[model samples]
Target: MEILTDYILQFGDLNKQQTDLIASKAKKLDLHKDDYFSEAGKIPKQVGFILEGVFRFCYYNNKGEEITNYFVEEGNFVVDYQKFHTQVIASEYIQAVTDCKILAFSRKDWEDILNTIVGWDKIEAKIYQKCMTQAIERRSPLVSEDATTRYLSFMEEFPKLINRIPLSYVASYLGITQQSLSRVRKNIR
Candidate 1:
């Protein structure tokens, strides 16, 4: 898909042949809301680039309550990076928040690109660093900000997601209760 090729191009140069090799590895998939792209305690088989919709990075607490920590929308890659890289069982879940279209690559296929492409390792590292940096920046506000401020920052940072996803997820991400989120919303307006 053009979307995927364009994204890879942003990180590094690729010839037609290299790009075709990548395209050949991509398997298009559809995931409906509430579907798990990858589940907790299972080894991830493939990594994906979101072509449509949103996904949440979540984990269960000791009491078995699922808490959403991060979200990935269209045009981003979604994976439990450390686990995927080590080929280990993931401790968290990557779940679809809305109907989604994704371009996936199996582990072997991803390794093929790394081995075959001259500068792919560097390119991959850059992409990973960028993703990690963005995650850190998004989370920093939550550590020190109040509930209202956290919600406000969330709205500003992910303006597109505010109306697209369930408010419960927004509440979880903001570290507040749904009732509190509702109160904050009412007070803000």
Candidate 2:
């Protein structure tokens, strides 16, 4: 809770009252490995900040293969932006790749903060911009790089996660087969 409060403080000033309100409404969530934080076809009624562990944002293709779109690590917010803002069911799933501890804010609480806090709009906008920039960075190497290059970039981008998560998930994120990822790792070594 302190970590989350500190993170929010980075974006804007929060008075004692505001901080207490946020802390009061925020709840802790514990998810075991493979548990889903959110799933396709469901509306996510809360926004979560990862205190510990990793989550993957994934979706099934037409052929039903799960493609990992993004990874949310500790200190990051995990929410389906479109679904959260529009009140629609999500098309993607946020799955815990490891046991997770999260600080979650209910939809109503989130709205309350926005309504009551000063400079929240600016804070929100800054957060959105950061998320957008991260998405763009994650997309660029996939389109422009070869398999080995992509794998290398993944290593650079998620050094901690590379060894923590199953290689299959990492392979999927890199758009390569597990066998290929293994070979790439061997070649690099």
Candidate 3:
């Protein structure tokens, strides 16, 4: 797919043979809204790149309430990185929030690609760095900022997501309640 090619190109250039190899290993799958790409306690076998729609990464607490962590939309990668890398059970769940098209490659297949392809190893390293940076950035504000400020910052950073995702999940991600989020929105308006 052009989208997959474009995304890969963002990290590094790929030769025709390398690209064809990758294309052969990558599988396209459609997910319905609320369908899970990966669930807690399962070993994540594949890494997915979102070609369309949105996905939410969440975890359930001891109280059995889902705590939203990350949101990935089109052109973004969505995978349980810890589980995928370590071949262990995932601690969080990844679910599609809307109908989604995803390009998936198994961990072994990706590793094989990296070993054989000239630039693929560097691309994988860069992807890991990007993922780590994003993870840190996402957690930093919560530790350093107050709830209202966090909510405001989220609104500013992801203006479109405010309209796309449910307010409840957004509130959970911001460490606030739906009622509190409503108040914050009203005050800002």
Candidate 4:
């Protein structure tokens, strides 16, 4: 709960009453490795904050291959925002890659909090902006950068990700085959 308070304090000050109100609406969840917080085609009811461990956003392509889109580590928020906001079924899945603990708030509860809390709207807007910027940066490299360059950049940005995630998923995100990723690693080593 203190983690939630810390996160809120980053955006604005919350008195004890306000903090308690928000905390009361949040639910704690524990997930095993490979457990899905939200699956494709399901309407996601809650947005989650990672208390521990890692989660990945993924989807299958036409060929039925899973493609990793984003990795949310501890101290981050995990939500399929488009579906959560629109009340539509999500196209992707949010899954735990390691045993995880999370604090989750229902969409309705979040909306209520936003309406009642001063300066919350601005905080939410900044969050959305960061999400969008990350998406743009990811797509830009795939569209314009060569494989080696992309691989190098990925290592520079998230060197630990290669060791943390499965090679297949990392390769998929890099738009390369696992063998290629292996070669890239070898080259770098």
Per TM-score, the best of the predicted structures is 1
Using alpha carbons, what is the TM-score of model 1?
Answer: 0.97
Estimate the TM-score for candidate 4. 0.89
TM-score, one value per model: 0.97, 0.96, 0.92, 0.89
Backbone clashes in each candidate structure, one number apiece?
Answer: 0, 0, 0, 0
> Which residue pairs show backbone clashes in model 2?
none
Better model by TM-score, 2 or 3? 2
Best by lDDT: 1
Off by over 4 Å in 4: none
Q: How far off is residue 66 in model 3, in Å?
A: 1.3
Q: Give candidate 2 misplaced runs (Cα > 4 Å).
A: none
Q: Rate the local accuracy (lDDT) of all candidates.
A: 0.92, 0.89, 0.86, 0.83
Per-candidate Cα RMSD to the true structure, in Å, reads: 0.9, 1.1, 1.6, 1.9
Ranking by lDDT: 1, 2, 3, 4
lDDT of 1 by residue, 1-189 (tens): 999889889998999998998899899999999999999889988889999999999998898877999999999998888888999999999999999999998899999988998999988898899899999999987989999999999998898999999999999888889999999999999
Candidate ranking under TM-score, highest first, comes to 1, 2, 3, 4
- The sequence of per-residue lDDT tens digits that candidate 2 reaches over residues 84-162 is 8789999999999999999888889988988988788789778877877897898787887999899888888888998
Candidate 4 global lDDT: 0.83
